[model samples]
Target: MKPLNITYIYDYANLQVEEVRGSNISLKNRLAKLEQALRNKDELAENLHVIDFEQLKIENQQLNEKIEERNEELHKLRKKTIVTVQIITHMREKVQFVQKEYQILKEELAQLDQDLGAQRDLVTKTKHERDEHRQEYASLKQQTGIMNSEHLTKDFKDRAERIKELKELITQLKKRHSQMSQFIKSHGGVI
Candidate 1:
């Protein structure tokens, strides 16, 4: 019986040792799988970091382009404003010049109107004087013609009276001559 007990105890001890060895092999396989999973997680984290960095760079470039476009638009607006101001100033100067010219022309026109009025007055006076002179000349001519007619009538009457006187003297001379001739014929009978 002691020998059989010793054999049974040795068989139980061997079985227990074999069970512990199987548990150790299973633990080693689980640890190897955990190490491989940790390595894969590290690789995935590195790829995500790179992707995030590229996305931030693209967003920064887009923001820069938008800022540049806004600056360009602002510059164009400033240039246009300057040009408009210059044009407005030029137009103002032209308007001022035109106004000055118009004022000068108006003054000149007023002076011309005054001159024309004076000239018209002078012409009217001269015409009145000319009409008076013409009337006077016509009156003088009529008066001269009347005086000449009166003088001619007086000369005709004087000539008619002188002719009558000469005829009477001739009649008296003939009578005297006839008497003298008869006396001489009677007294000279025998001389």
Candidate 2:
């Protein structure tokens, strides 16, 4: 009654040990499958990171090109502004020169006007003197005409009588001249 049989106990213990070993093997296989899945996930993440980095680099290049284009446009605008300013300055100078020339021309015109006024005065004086001389000549002609009329009236009839008497005298003078001519010829003088 005090000593139990140990052979049956040993057989039961052996059966339990076999079951524990089988369970341990199944757990190890499951852990191996989980590790392989983790490795695949890590590779997928690395590929996505590379794609994101490439996209970022392309966007940066595009932005840099746009900036360069804007800078070139700004430079052209600056050059155009400078040219416009220079043109404005040249125009201003030309306007000032024209103003000065206009002033000079105005002065010259004023002097010409004064000279013309003086010439006009001389012409007026000459015309007045000519008129006075014409009046004086007309007065002298009138006086001469009056004197001729008076002398003609005084001697008109007497001169006619004297012309008749002188005609008879001219006959006698012709007879005497003929006698004198014959006498001069006989005397050998120039007849």
Candidate 3:
């Protein structure tokens, strides 16, 4: 974990780095002016050279430290940005995976819907076929009943006609039998 002080240091370093950059430009100008003075061998330039050189060295060292500190902060920030980018890439991949799964589920649902429709059609067709078969069976049953009834009626009529004829024949035979018996009685011989 980064210490909280590092955040303060980074902020301070950023401000100092900008100040040091501006100081560096001034330092360059002063150095240039010092060079010009030294070439002319000015007496005052000779007397203040050590003090000014020492002061320049101290400022240069401070500026270098500030630059180094700012570079360190930038390095940390770069690493954090890289990690953030990686995390973002991972999230994007997860989203794509979920999307693919969703597409597959949608396709499966569509197929199931089609299957359901087909099954419903099959059920309807089966019911229709079953009804047709029932109707055919009922028609055949009705025809069979009519044939049976007609046969029964014809048999009853034939039986009744035969019974009437037999009754007539029996009456005629009884009359003949009575006549024969009377004739025999009338011809009664005592001999």
On lDDT, the stronger of 1 and 2 is 2
Instruction: Note the Cα lDDT for every prediction shown.
Output: 0.86, 0.88, 0.91
Candidate 2 lDDT for residue 1: 70
TM-score of 1: 0.37
In candidate 1, position 158 carries an lDDT of 89
The list of candidate 1 runs beyond 4 A from truth reads 1-67, 134-191
Q: Candidate 1: global Cα-lDDT?
A: 0.86
lDDT (Cα, 0-100) at 169 in candidate 1: 84
lDDT of 2 by residue, 62-141 (tens): 99999999999999999999999999999999999999999999999999999999999999999999999999988887
lDDT of 1 by residue, 19-130 (tens): 7777777777777777778777778767877887788889889989999999999999999999999999999999999999999999999999999999999999999999
Ranking by TM-score: 2, 1, 3
Backbone clashes, candidate 1? 0
Score every model by TM-score. 0.37, 0.40, 0.37
Q: Model 2, stretches more than 4 Å misplaced?
A: 1-66, 144-191
The deviation in Å at residue 48 for candidate 3 is 3.1
The numbered model that scores best in TM-score is 2
Report the number of clashing residue pairs per model. Answer: 0, 0, 0
Model 2 RMSD in angstroms: 13.4
Clashes in predicted model 2: 0
